[model samples]
Target: MTPLSPDDYTAIRLSLQVATSATIIALPLGFAAAYLLAFSEIRGKAIIEGIINLPLVLPPVVVGYLLLLLFGRNGWIGKLLNHFGISVIFSLKGAVIASAIVGFPLLVRSIRIGMESIDKQYIHASRTLGASWWDTLFSITIPLCYRATLAGMTLMFARSLGEFGATIILAGNIPGVTQTIPLAIYQYTSTPGGDQMALSLCIVSIGLSFIVLLLSEAANRKMARN
Candidate 1:
C-alpha cells in the first residue's frame, strides 16, 4: 500500500467531513422537495422536477459555475452573507455547498421514488381520518418509506465523497481547508512523481464507493424481503 502523507490524510478526513455535512444539511430539504414532487397537486410539477433534476443532467462544471454565481462575493446572496462576515467562496463551507448542490438531484430522486412507491390508499385513509398532509407525511409517508430515505441519504453521501468540479470551483482546493479526496487526486495527477499517490487515492475512492453501493444493495434486499 502506498503510504499517505499528512496532507493526504487531511484530504481523506476533510472529504468525509464535507460529504457527511453536505448530505445531512440537505436531508430535510430533499425530503420536502421529494414529497412535494411525489404527492403534491401543484401546478408546474414537471417544471419543478426538471429543475430539481437539472444537476443530474447538467455538466458538473456548469453546476459549479452556477454555484459560484450564487455564492461569489458580489452575488446577491453572497453580498448579504458577507455583510454578516460569512463567506462561502474559497472556504470549507463552500465545499459543502458545492457538494450539496451537485448531489441534490440524486437525493431528491431517491426519496421521490420512495415516496411514490408508497400506496395511495394510506394517504387517502389518513386524509379521511382527518389527518392533515403534514400528519400523513410524518406518520405514514416517512415511516413506510424509510428505506427510500435511507437509500437517498447513502447515495448523496457517496456522490458528495467523489465531488470534484464544483468543490474546486467554489472552494479553490486549499490544502487542509477545502482540499477533498478528489481535489487531492487532481493535484497528484498534475505533479511530477505523483502517480503512485494518485493511484492510492483512486483506490481509496473506489473502495469507499463500492462499500456504499454494497450497503445500498443490502438495504434494498432487506426492504424487499420485509
Candidate 2:
C-alpha cells in the first residue's frame, strides 16, 4: 500500500476533470445522434451510423494518429484553430477531445437503445395533440429517455477515466496537465520500483468506476419509480 504522491493526486483530479468534461460536452450531441439514428428515415443512415461508430472499432492509437494528422499545424483544423491562437496538441483540451471521441460511440449507442425502447404510441399521441416536432422531442422523447441518457453519460465518463492510448498520443501525458489516471498508471509501471504506485492508482480507478456504477443504478431506480 503505497501513499500517492502529489503528481498522483493531480492525475486523479485531472482524470475526473477530463471525464466529466468529456461526458458533459458529448451529452447533447450524443442524444441528437441517438434520436436521428433511432427515428430518422433519411437515406445513407447506415453510412452515417457507421461513421459515428468508427472510433469504437478503430484502435485508440490509430484514432489518435488520425486526430494528430487532422490537428497538426498543417492540418485544416489546426490551421483554423491557430487563427484564433487556440491549441490542442499536448494540452488538456486535447486530452478531453481524445476522451470524448473515444467514448462518444458508447454514449450514442446507449442513448439510441433508450430511444428505440420508447413506444411509438406516445410520439403519435403527442403529434395528434398538436405538439410540434421540437415540443415532442423536449417534452416527450427526452423525458422518456432520461435513464438511457444517464446511462450513456456514466459509460462515457467511466471510459474517459480509463482512456490511455489516444490521450497519451494526442496530449503527451504531461504531468499536472494532460496526465490522467490511466496515463499515470502507465508512467508508474514503466519506471523501476514503481509497481506500488501503479497499483495504488489502479485501486483508485476501480473505486471510481464502482462508484459510477452504483450511482447510475441508483439514478435509474429513482427514475423508474418516478
Candidate that would win on TM-score: 2
lDDT of 1 by residue, 1-226 (tens): 6898999999999999998999999999999999899989999999999998998998888898898999898888899999899999999999999999999999999999989999999999999999998898899989888888888999899999999988888899899999999999999999999999999999989998898889888987888798
* RMSD to truth, every model: 1.6, 0.8
Model 2, range 80-160, lDDT digits (tens) per residue? 999999999999999999999999999999999999999989999999999999999999999999998999999999999
lDDT of 1 at 14: 96
Q: Which candidate number maximizes lDDT?
A: 2
Give candidate 2's TM-score: 0.98
The residue pairs found clashing in candidate 2 are: none
Candidate 2 deviant stretches above 4 angstroms: none
In each prediction, how many residue pairs overlap at the backbone (N, C-alpha, C within less than 3 A)?
Answer: 0, 0
Residue pairs that clash (backbone atoms under 3 angstroms), model 1: none
In model 1, what is the error at residue 177, expressed in angstroms?
0.3
